[model samples]
Each structure stands twice: as C-alpha cells, then as structure tokens.
Target: MQTSKSTTRIISISFFTLALLGCQSAYYGALEKVGIHKRDVMVSRVESANETQLEAKQQFQTALQKFKSVRQFNGGNLENIYETLNDEYETSAALADKINSRINDIESVSDALFEEWEKELSEYTSESLKQKSAQQLTKTKSQYRRLIRAMKNAETSMKPVLNVFKDQVLFLKHNLNAQAIASLKGELNNIESNVATLIKQMNKSIDEANQFIKTMSQ
Candidate 1:
C-alpha cells in the first residue's frame, strides 16, 4: 500500500509538469504571433504615411511651378508699368502682395491640416474680382495678357532663375532662407523685366476670359 501511494504521487507530479510545459509553450506561441502582428501593423502604417507625404510633396512642387509661372507673368506686367513710369516702389509692393498671397495658397494646400484655408483663399479671390464694370473687366483682361507675355520672357531668361529656385528649394528643405528682403530687391528688378513681358500676354488672356464670361451672361 505504501509503494502504491508513492507511485501515485510520482505520476501526479509528472502530469502537472507536462501540463505546465504545454501552457508555457502556448503562451510563448501567442506572444510571438502578437509581436509579428504588431510589426506588420507598424510597417503598414509607415508605408501609408510615406506615400501620403510623397504625394503631398509632388503636388506642392507642381503647384509651386505653376505659381512661379504666374508670378513671372505678373512681374512682366509690373515691369512694363515701372519702365514706362519709374514707380519701382509701388510695383514692388504690389508684386510682394501678390507673391505673398500665392505663397499662402501653396502652403495651405500643401499641408493637409490647412486645406480649409485654400478653400477660403479661392473664395476670397473669386468674390473680390466678381464685382467689376465692363471697362474694368477689359482692363484686367488686358493686364493679364501683358502678364502672360512677361512670363514667357521670364521663362526664356530663367536659366539662372531656375538655378536660384533649385538652390532655394534645397535651402528651404533645410529650413533656411536663401535671400534677405533687401537682397531680393535686386532679384526682383531682374524678375520684373521678365514679368513685364508676361503681363502683356496675360492681360490679353484675361480680357478674353472676361469677354467669355460676359457673353455667357448675355
């Protein structure tokens, strides 16, 4: 009877040890699976974020190019006026305002959080320009054509400008400002010459656009 009791105790201990080992194996397997799942989730999230950022960057770059083209045109228009009547300061101010407004639009659109700002900017420009007499519309259109011509000229002269812009982008990427406002005065003068030519072309286009609107209204 004593021998039977001792054998029974040994069997119970063996069974408990096997059961504990089985539970530990299962726990470790579950932890490994959880770790793998977590890793996959993190990878997916990182890929998604990278894609979003890349797309945003591409869009911003395209938009910036278009904006620069427009600016070149506007500068040409201002240049014509400045050349005809040396009102450098006034022209500079106007161009500065225009550039700032465009930059704001670009920045707002580039950032996902500032999308609403882009919408407001569009609304503001549309509304502000909506109320115009036929003569004013005509003049605006003429001005737009002039601006376009200026842009074309600026584009032609843009080998150096392009280089500068590329350098500026690199600097901006590193959170640096490439040129000071005072320094930009000279650059603006050079830019103005190109812009003046574009402005003439743009003015004509604007006139045509306005005329089309008028016709549609009729």
Candidate 2:
C-alpha cells in the first residue's frame, strides 16, 4: 500500500510539472506574437513617412520650375525694354544693374536649395525625418515673390524717367535757337537730377526686397 501511494504521488508531481511548462510555453508564444505585431506597425509607419517625403519633394520641384519660368520671362522682357530706350537718359544702366542683381539672388537660392533637397530626398525613408522640406518649399516661393516685386518696382520707376528724358530731348530738338537751347539744357539737367533721385530710391527698394528674400530663404 505504501508503494502504491508513493507511485501515485510521483505521477501527480509529473503531471503538475508538465502543466506548468505548458503554461510557460504559451506565455512566451504570446509575447513573440505581440512583438511581431509591433514590428509590423512600425514598418507601416516608416513607409508612410517615406511617401510623405516623396510627395513634398515633388511639390517643391513643381514650384521651383514655375518660378524659373516666370523669372526668365520677366528678365527677357526687361532686357528688351532697356535695349529699346536711348542711352542718354542713363536709366538703362541702373535698371540693368537692378535686374541682374535680382536674377543673381534668385539663382543663388534656387540652386542651393535644389542641391540640398536632392540630398535630403535620397535619405528620407521614415516619417519622423529631421528635415522640414515643406517649410523650405514655402519659404522659397516667398523669396521668388519678393524678387518679382523688386523687378516690377524697378520697371515702374524707370518709366517716368524715360518719359521725362523723351520730352526734354524732343523740346531741344524743336527749339534750336542759342537762348532756347541754353534754357532747354538747364531743364534737361534738372530732369536728369530727378531721374537720379528716382534711381536711388528704386535701388534702395530693390536692396531691401532682396535682403528680405535672403532672410526668408535662410
């Protein structure tokens, strides 16, 4: 009877040990499944982030292209207009300088950002990227707007100066007497002074606008 009792106790202990091991195995399996699920979620998030970056990059490219096209058109028109005007007014030189300055400013920003953007785009594969590409794009567009404004102001200021020069030249051409010629020369000098002042103001405005654009781009 003692032998029977001892054998029964052994059997009960073995069954309890097996049951405990089964519970541990099930717990570990459940933990592994949870870990795999978390990994999948993380991977999905990373993919989404990459997609967002790509989309932002495309938008930036489009904006930049548009800016370039408009800039070229404005620059060409300005050149043609300046070339048609008489050189005596001294307006073309100042206008050309302003236009060139603006073109340089625009090119500097677009070229630098374009290179940086290409580099950043290649490395962007996650959603929590360090680079804020969209903000950069918006800033670039704002810079372009400032450049356009500066060009327009320069053009507008030049018109009045050209008109005054034209009127004075026409007057001198018609009134050829010595006294009339002397008086017309004096009048032309005064018109020239006014033109100089306008050019100075236009330069200041262009400088301020360019500086503002540079600040925004940075």
Candidate 3:
C-alpha cells in the first residue's frame, strides 16, 4: 500500500513539474512575441519601484506640510484640517502598500531571471564563454543583492514614520480642538526628523535602483 502511495505521489509530482514548465515556456514565448524579455521586465519593475518611492516621498512631504499648516490654525473650520490630515494618512498608507507591492514584484522577477541565467550558463559549450558568463552572473548577483538591500532598508525606514503619522492623525481625529493642535505642535520636530530620515533612505534607494538598472542594461 505504501509503495503504491509513493508511486502515486511521484506521478503527481512529475505531472505538476511538467505543467509548470509548460506554463513557463508559454509565458516566455508570449513575452518574446511582444519584444519583452525577463530582463526587460526586471528593469521595468525596478523603475516602477523608484517611481513609487518618489511618489511616496512627495506624499510624505505633503503630509508634513499639511501638518505644519494646521499648527497655525488659530480659528475657523477645524473640520477642514481634520479632513486634510485624514486624507494624508490614507494616501500615505496606500502609497506605502503600493511601494511594498512593487518591491515584491521586483523580487519575483529577479529570482526567476537569476535562476534562468545560472541554468543557461551550464548549457554553454565553450569553456571561455561559460567562464565569462559565470563571472558576469556572480557580479550581477552581488550588485542585485546590494540594490535590493538598499531598497528594503528604505522600505523599512518608512514604517516608523508612517506609524508616527498615523498616531498623530488618530489623535487629532479624536481631539479636534485647540488643545489637539497644541499637542501636535509638540510633535512637529520629531515628525520632521523622521521624515527627513525617510527621505534620505528613499534617495539612497533610488540611486541604487538607477545604478542597478544602468548596469543591467549594459
């Protein structure tokens, strides 16, 4: 009975592996039909990630500006300030989510591309060509690791800033009065520092991404 079960499992595994390979072959074929390769997809994903970081930076800056503007609220529609703060919080949260998704997409394509590159290196007939390709693969992989580390570091830096923003937004939401405004004023300096740090990390990540893209293109 155990032998039969093992045989059944082996067959199932073989079928699944064949199906996966067939699907991947079809996917690559379609991509080639449109002049898109895995390398192109990876580059595009990196660019998309950079763009998302840029957008996120802008959104955070806008939120900070709005927060500062609210500090000067001596009178008039407090509701407007609340609405703006809430909007900023929601928008920033959404941008963070998008940035994270872009990072994941980049990672997915990167793993597939690197795996394919490694596998193809073994298929090269000429020793010289294989050696060269292997060196290039090693270098590319090293560069990619650095680039991804920078990107992930930047992504990690954003969390604390976002948390602070959320807390302030929630506090203000619950206490929409002069006291709340006064309390927020106390947090301004810390928020500014966190935002600055976040922006620096983002800029570093962007530079790393651009460098990686240029290297890959070469």
* C-alpha TM-scores of all predictions: 0.22, 0.39, 0.86
lDDT (Cα, tens digit) per residue for candidate 2, span 85-134:
22343444344444545444444434444555556656767645635665
Candidate 3 versus truth, CA RMSD in Å, comes to: 4.6
Query: RMSD for each model, in Å, please?
Result: 26.7, 29.3, 4.6
lDDT of 2 at 172: 40
Q: Residue 78 of model 3: what lDDT?
A: 72
lDDT for position 86 in model 2: 29
Identify the runs in model 2 with alpha carbons over 4 angstroms from their true place.
1-87, 90-123, 128-131, 178-197, 209-218
- Candidate 1 stretches greater than 4 Å from native: 1-186
lDDT of 1: 0.39
Candidate number that wins on lDDT, 1 or 2: 2
Best by TM-score: 3
| lDDT tens digits, residue span 153-217, model 3 | 88888888888888888887888888878878888898999989989999999999999999989
119-186, model 1: which lDDT tens digit per residue? Answer: 44445445545444334445534543453344333223333433443443333334323232223334
The worst-scoring run of ten residues by lDDT in candidate 2 lies at 67-76
Task: Please give the CA lDDT of all the candidate structures.
Answer: 0.39, 0.47, 0.88
